[model samples]
Structures are given as C-alpha cells and as structure tokens.
Target: MIDRRDALAGIVAMFGATLFAPIARAASVQVAVIDTGPPSSAVFTAGQRALVSALSERVIPTTDTPGAIAAEVPQFIEKLLADWARPEDKEPILAGLGAIETRSRRDYKVAAADATPEQQDALLTLAMNDQLPGGADFFDKFRQLVITGYYTSEIGITQEREYLPVPGKYDGAYPYARVTKVFSS
Candidate 1:
C-alpha cells in the first residue's frame, strides 16, 4: 500500500505551484473519502461533470490499459469534491473547470466541450504550463485528483499494474527486468 500523502506530494511536484494568491481558501477541516464507491449523489453539475470527464479521459486516455474513464476517475473526482474536498477547495476546482472553457474560447473561439480534441489538448497543455492566468492552481489540483483517483482504483491497481495479495518466500535472486510492470499490494 502506498502512502497517499507522499504520492500526492510527489505528483504535486510534477507541476510547479502557483505563487500568486490562492484563488480559493482551503478549509481547515479535511473531508476526503477515497474509499467506498462513486458518489451516490452527483457532486458537479451536468456541465461540470461533462467537463471533468473530458479532462480526465484526456489526462489519462484509454490505451492498452484501462483509461481514466474506465477506472471511474471522473466519478471518483466528483465524489472527492462532493464528499471529501474542503469547502474552500471546491470553488477553485470549479473555477479550474471553467478556466478550460474560457481558454477554449480564447484559443479556439468555441466552448471547451465543443473544441476539437487537438484544440482541447492544446488548452490542457497551456494549463500544464502554469502560465495561464488564475488557472495554474486549478490545473495542479485537478491533476492531483485525477492521478490519485486513477491509481487507487481497482482497474488501476489490477489491470494497469500487477497486484499481489499474498507473497511467497522472498526470492533475492529473482530475475527482473528494469521495465517490468509495477506490482501493487
């Protein structure tokens, strides 16, 4: 089992932090629910959910391994936002979603969902750049949520990576390839 805190910290470093003022204040109370299933009640609105799904699938598209959608990353994110994320974190999260649309319009002269995949990808790249006005924080937070949710999902653990329930005797001399798929417990 991985320590999620460590995992998040490492992933957060994947993109630099925003030096500007925080768009949304963080809640003192922590409210994350990584366990259980997709939210029983919807957290984001229909439009928001759709945007989240698009962003998630793009972030981790369907390949040989199950993609973010297959792993229920969007649903998981919604649950985290609705049930777990701090109240202050919510506004910025939603703003991040809206920022995609805003960027889409600016770049492609169309709604984010209406933008072509290539165009959307371009916008996402901008988000990743940390140069977009008021969008860097949202991008970092969204990226963290997607990565965390996907890796922790059943499909991510089993289909994407090897999972060992019970280990046999330790084999110090086991032949291993440097590129072997990671195994998770």
Candidate 2:
C-alpha cells in the first residue's frame, strides 16, 4: 500500500529528473513553452519594442551564455504585460520606458535603442541609482522580469549549463566537489 508520504516522495523524485534533462532545439522548445506565442496584441509599438529589446540585451549581455535578447526576454515581458499586468502596474512601466527615452534623447541626442551600448549602460545605472524620478521602482521590476524570463527560457536551461535528458535517479549523496558549474533547469 502506498502511503501519502511515499507517494509524495515518488512524485518529487520523478519531477526532479527533469531539472537536468536535455532540451530539444531552441525554437521547438520555445514553441512548446510559449505555444500562444508573444501576445497577439503586444502593447509596445515598433519603437517601443526596439527600446525594450535593446534594454533587455543590456540587462543580460552576451557572455559565454546567450543574452536576454537571445532568450526572448523582451517578448516574454510583452506577453506578461498584455496578459497579466494591471493598469496601475503596466502604466508606470510604460511611463518609465518613455522617460528613459526622453532622458536618452536629452543627454545623447538619440533614443535608448539608438544610443551606444556604453551610454545605455550609463543611463540604466543612473536610473537605478535614483537619479531618474521613479526609476528605482521601474528598473527593479523590469530587471527582475528580464532575469526570470531569461532563466526560464529553454536556451538558458540547456546550452547555458549541462543538459542530460532523463537524468535518471536523483542521488541523495551526489558530491558537491564534482560540480564545475551549477546545473541549470
């Protein structure tokens, strides 16, 4: 007879195997995860999309790992805003994006996307430092979304770290000394 505790443990052990599982192709995996695709009614304009894309790329630049843009962070964010964010939450974010552009234009004579990467970096840092009005709130939230979206994406989970499909049993005694980089889910 399977007791509740035993059943729960079995479920957890089974689910845990997926954490180290090899991912499929990037596009296929992305399609599987976001079958609905980026919001059909994406809120941002072409220019706004460009701004967020550039900003997301800056937030998680291409390292050995692919950056936020490669992880499709901006699209995920647009979907979240379209489907989940309330007016109060969404409005401030949009306003902040516009503000960044305004500041960029004023300081650099270009939009945020048009500004050089270094200038974008400086502007983002300045905004985070409370130099821009209400920037702290916007930057913090936007940064978190970009981060979460990136890590949750398939490319981040597979190529960024080791992937082994059907990772077999979860070893309670797996040695930490054997780890080079922390495995991604």
Q: TM-scores of the models, in the given order?
A: 0.74, 0.74
Q: For model 1, how does the per-residue alpha-carbon lDDT over 30-99 read when each residue is reduced to its tens digit? A: 7865666656667687877888888888888889998999999988888877777655667877877778
List candidate 1 stretches off by more than 4 Å: 1-42, 172-174
Instruction: Name the candidate that leads on lDDT.
Output: 2
Candidate 1 backbone overlaps, count: 1
> Candidate 1, which ten residues in sequence have the lowest lDDT sum?
9-18
Across 1-185, the per-residue lDDT of candidate 2 in tens digits comes to 55677576665542332355555635543433434655767688898899899989999999988999999889888988887555455776787788898899999999898999999998888778868877888799889889888877887777666666788889889999997665875
True-structure RMSD, every candidate = 7.4, 10.4
Candidate 1 displacement at residue 170 in angstroms: 3.1
